[model samples]
Target chain A: MTGSLIILQPGHSVVTDLGRTKGPAYGLPVNGALDQFSAKAANILAGNADNDPLLELTALDFRMRATTDLLIAVTGAPLDLTVGGRESPQWEPVSVRAGEVVAVRGIRTGLRAYIAVHGSFTVPSLLGSCAPDTVVGFGLKLVEGFRLETRTTTAPITQPHFGLPLFRLGITKPAFTTNPVIDVTDGPDVAEFGDTAGLLFTTQYAVSPRSNHIGLRLGGALPERQLTSEVLSRGVPVGAIEVPSRDELLVLHRGRGVTAGYPVLAVVTSRSLDLLAQARPGHTVTFRRTTVAEATATHRTACLELERLRQTINTVFGLLGIGAGQRWYELSPASGA
Target chain B: MAATTTTTSQTTLDIYESGDAALRVVARSGDAETNWATVHSLAGWLAATGVEGIHGAVPTYDSVLVEFDPYLTSARQVRAFVLLGMRQLDFVGTTLREPRRFEVPVVYGGDYGPDLDRVAEHQGLDVEDVIARHTAKTYVIRCLGAPAGSPMMDGPDFPVPVPRLKDPRLSVPAGAVSVAGRQAVIAPAVAPGGWCVIGQTPLTVLDAAREPLVPYVPGDELRFYRIPAEDFGNFAGQFLEARP
Candidate 1:
């Protein structure tokens, strides 16, 4: 069936997916939903695959109207959710009639939110993904009056339902708060920090306003280092906490460059990366070091719990009518392990 | 999370957990060889091994950033495997493979290359002579960095180092071939650059939609040939753009 969503007042939104994991080798960054866990939850609740195209609203004032009857689910940072001027619950499936207006107001807490429908967005794809990557020039970057057309069938309209406890930092939360604690592990260049590595944990850093999807600039004390010769520019990963000579520390996010020049003192854990996604500008963040074993343990627990929750939500909201081509999303907890 | 375990005596391989989901295998010391071919070859060889959870290895000059899955492969396992792979690289020998070369036609000097005269002046040489020195031989693509698909390659032999721009240009057009130090780079997009612009190539080196996408990968070769500025309009690479 053909249906469309008209943005009444677009406030920084883009059509995104789980992003392309395979394209990074071609000098592409892994461009996807910053808060992947919540995006997947939104997709599952909307009766779509976890990697289905999502209208990721980064700004707070996102308003749209349905041109046709639509089954949708909103997740991530809880905002002033409304459907046709009535308050709607976050983290659950809901129905909107034709001409019904749905709006999400100034993000109450988190940095972004996900609006997933029970179908795929009829946008262009690049390098085998539909995610919008400004760095790589893929898909559409939505603006005001933009229309998100979709190819989806009629999904069962259910009464307002609630999802499981929130997923964050390897723990389920009844509600999310601002400036959550983040866990990190040693980076490839962690040894270079030497004694200065302690500064990564002892000092608290605030997310600077300059922060965007590309990186989170943190204002903090410089991590001390022995003045060694220049190290060659190397590949940097998502969540790598890179420190330049005199500038602020930067945490490479989902939209990070494929490689960089500075040394990375620490790397935020995968589970904590989702938490980092929710961190708004001005949010104070502190790092807690975790061993590879500990990080792996929590990452596994988080993935298993998320998979179980996805199945539960799919059963609750009913599966999407996707075919063999788009039947299942590859949800490898550890990069296709 | 632990101390590095070297697998070979010739060089130490430092394999450690990079982030939560990846392990990086680095050659701790510089190889006797030049231009980082050994490290890049090691990365390619490891990628060819088909080890579990090893997603991709992004090689810089001297290190391979190996991304692994913590679920299917532990850091210890990936590290050990990568160490073994390094040892295998030693046994098989990372021969300097022949690089694919493309003759990039450029319009040197004048408005197309704003800093050509300055670069020639800095080196105390005539502009035509500088151009002759640059186009003398093929340059090897070392790494694509600084900007996306911006190929950094070995520069032509010169008596002195080429001076960088005192101030960076706000908008450097794509295909602006420039040089500094012992290396050269072809600007792929409009970005602020401080490199001394020797010429402007009409050929597109970096396009996301091209069949091969980028014109040069690591270990490829690029050659510069002087072309009349009007001849720049003859090539299709000048008009190629990413359709997204």
Candidate 2:
């Protein structure tokens, strides 16, 4: 796909994919989409690979217009999506004609959303990803009035023919809960916190206003430590629930730096991290304890589900005479052509 | 969480599960310097081996965080890979490649180094004395972290550990040479930081467009030399290179 998308109303949006996997060794933080599940779903719906670069829109109000016909899908955060001034459903692929506008706004239940087009966005890749790192000011910085190009080679599908029938995927709407009980496994230093670590599960935490892609500073009963010694500055993983000397617990997110000095009491499960990403400021979250094996199994299941869905999509499209790797817009030019 | 240990020669590597997707390999028993060397050696070994499903191996002072795809590699499998790398590191010793040295040109005291006087006053010394002590010793690169590609080097030979700013600056300009406790770092990019910035370098420490984005590796050596503030504009955006 080789067309451009013009931002009519820019929100806090950035191009994201499964960010640089090898850059962390050089002190780079993984700056991918916060909600991986939704980002993948959106990409799959738009007939792209799971790791294709797409727009990750944080809660604000986003509006964009396409210069060519494209298949686009919006997923994550139960937001109101409007296409060409008409209400459209989220999570399903929708064909938009050239010059049609797509707006996503009024995202009350969650904090972020994913918008994936038929092809990946063309952005400067650092360490092999377009995901922007706000901390170091690296990668593409999206702004209002900026035009983003994609790899679409198809022309605008203006002519409507009965022979060409575009089909959208039938998917169950994902739930966006304001108050969610997240699952977490005990971290390596959980024992150092002593009895106070139990408070993590019992007390409800409200996502603090200071939360960002780097981390989520939760406000609630703080976890106390028995040993008041400083932890060594070492490599810390994303989703680590670190207990600082004082104040509330800070949960590391995707944009977290490679190493940190705080003590980690628990780590959010990989599957639960997708749900945690949607948590906005003031959203209540309670963590439940789980084993690593259980969490691992859950994540494996999710991966398999996505794989099955991908296969089904390919089969359906193939049966409809859309050749392998051919987009819906590239279907043999209308019957009378 | 269960901690697994692998003994290879003198170094003992302990693998602890950071999460389902990440495993942390720590030096069980060693001094800070020895542990850092052991950790970094393992990081280098892992990269050289290119183990399957291993996403990234980040080295710290005494630990290396190895991230992998949970779906493709299990925590147990990751532990085995780390143990295998540890064994390979024992054969190679700590040095994977020869350490390169760099002469970093820095302008101290003024708009470039706003906290130079503060550091000197806190240590009960003159700004010139502080600058002299900082440049007296050659430091080794420990690791890189914080604002991406920022090189954390062994501390300067200061009488006392310098304290970090109580309140971190919202944005520390790129190429800022900062210090905290016994460690020093050059802010490779513009980001929020809490370290005491005593000087600034005009050379570009990191650039994504350039191949080998960061010039120095973990075992590299660096020596900072004083430069006149008037020469700052003469070397702007110059890529930092090691001595030929």
Isolated chain A TM-score, each model: 0.87, 0.91
Which residue segments of model 2 deviate by more than 4 Å? A153-168, A321-337
Residues forming the 10-long window of minimal summed lDDT in candidate 2 chain A: A156-165
Q: What is the Å distance of residue B73 in model 1 from its true position?
A: 4.0
DockQ of 2: 0.70
Candidate 2 accuracy as TM-score: 0.94
Can you give the DockQ of every candidate in the order shown?
Answer: 0.49, 0.70
lDDT (tens digit, per residue) of candidate 2 on B15-122? 787878898888976678788888888888888888888888889888888898899988888887787777766776777478899999999989899999999999
The second chain of candidate 2 has a TM-score of 0.96
Each prediction's fraction of true contacts recovered = 0.47, 0.74
Count of steric clashes across candidates, in order: 0, 5
Best-performing candidate as measured by lDDT:
2
Off by over 4 Å in 1: A159-175, A318-337, B9-11, B28-35, B45-52, B87-98, B121-126, B159-170, B192-194, B236-244
